[model samples]
Target: DQQVKQNSPSLSVQEGRISILNCDYTNSMFDYFLWYKKYPAEGPTFLISISSIKDKNEDGRFTVFLNKSAKHLSLHIVPSQPGDSAVYFCAASDSSGNTGKLIFGQGTTLQVKP
Candidate 1:
């Protein structure tokens, strides 16, 4: 049973447009949500994160929203640029465990066409 899932394998957007990525989790234990951006052959880079306690969090042009009741989350990137084209991954952690283990969803490849 995969706890985290990104149903969409890929997404395409035009430059300066908005890009939205969605994620869902089956485990209610997940209390923290994180988004990561990755380029081929490079380690994933942390983008933004939100706690289950908050419904929304925003930083710069990136925003993350979490609906605890639905066990769902989404990342929004506004005015997406060509440089923003990359594989995005959503990850969740159960802070109660304190083991520092994260469950990652299958990444969604984002193509920002310029």
Candidate 2:
């Protein structure tokens, strides 16, 4: 069973517009959620994250929102730029004593058109 899922496979946004990505999880043990942006042939780089204690977290033009009750989360990017085009993966981890292994979704490819 997939604990984490990204329903949308891809998203396209015009430059200076807004880009939104959605993710869902079924595991209640996930206490930490993270979003990562990846370029071709490169490892994913952390974008933003939110703890289960917080409903929202923002970093610069990127923001992550979590709904613990719904077991869902989303990432929003404002004023999307060309450089923002990349594959985004939603990851979850639990810090409840065991190993902190990250479970990542397939990924959502975001294209920011100039």
Candidate 3:
């Protein structure tokens, strides 16, 4: 069962613009959500994260929002830069299990044009 899903396979945004990436989950057990950014031939790096207790979290130009009721989440990049272009993945973990295992989305390719 694919618990996490990114409906949009890709998103294109102009540089210095705001980019929004969306994700949805079928499992309500997920309590911790994380976003990862990856480039070609490189491992994914953590971007931003949010917990079930909180609706939003922000760091620098990246922000993540969670809607528990909707079982959805989004990543917002303000003033997106060319460097921000990458394959972004949405990950979620069930803290209740404490197994440290995470479920990931198919990933969305974000292209920031200059």
lDDT of 2 at 89: 100
- lDDT (CA) per prediction: 0.97, 0.96, 0.97
Task: Compose the digit string of candidate 3's lDDT tens values, residues 5-104.
Answer: 9999999999999999999999989999999999999999999999999999999999999999999999999989999999999999999998999999
In model 1, where do residues sit more than 4 Å from their true spots? none
Pairs in steric clash, model 1: none
* Comparing 1 and 2 on TM-score, the stronger one: 1
Q: Total clashing residue pairs per candidate?
A: 0, 0, 0
What tens-digit string does per-residue lDDT give for candidate 1 at 1-113? 88999999999999999999999999999999999999999999999999988999999999999999889999999989999999999999999999889999999999999
Off by over 4 Å in 3: none
Q: Which pairs clash inside model 2? A: none
Q: Point out the worst 10-residue segment of candidate 1 by lDDT.
A: 67-76
TM-score of each: 0.98, 0.97, 0.98
Off by over 4 Å in 2: none
Q: What is the lDDT of residue 43 in candidate 3?
A: 100
lDDT of 2 by residue, 23-61 (tens): 999999999999999999999998999999999999999
Q: How accurate is candidate 2 locally (lDDT)?
A: 0.96
Candidate 3 residue 87 Cα shift, in angstroms, is: 0.3
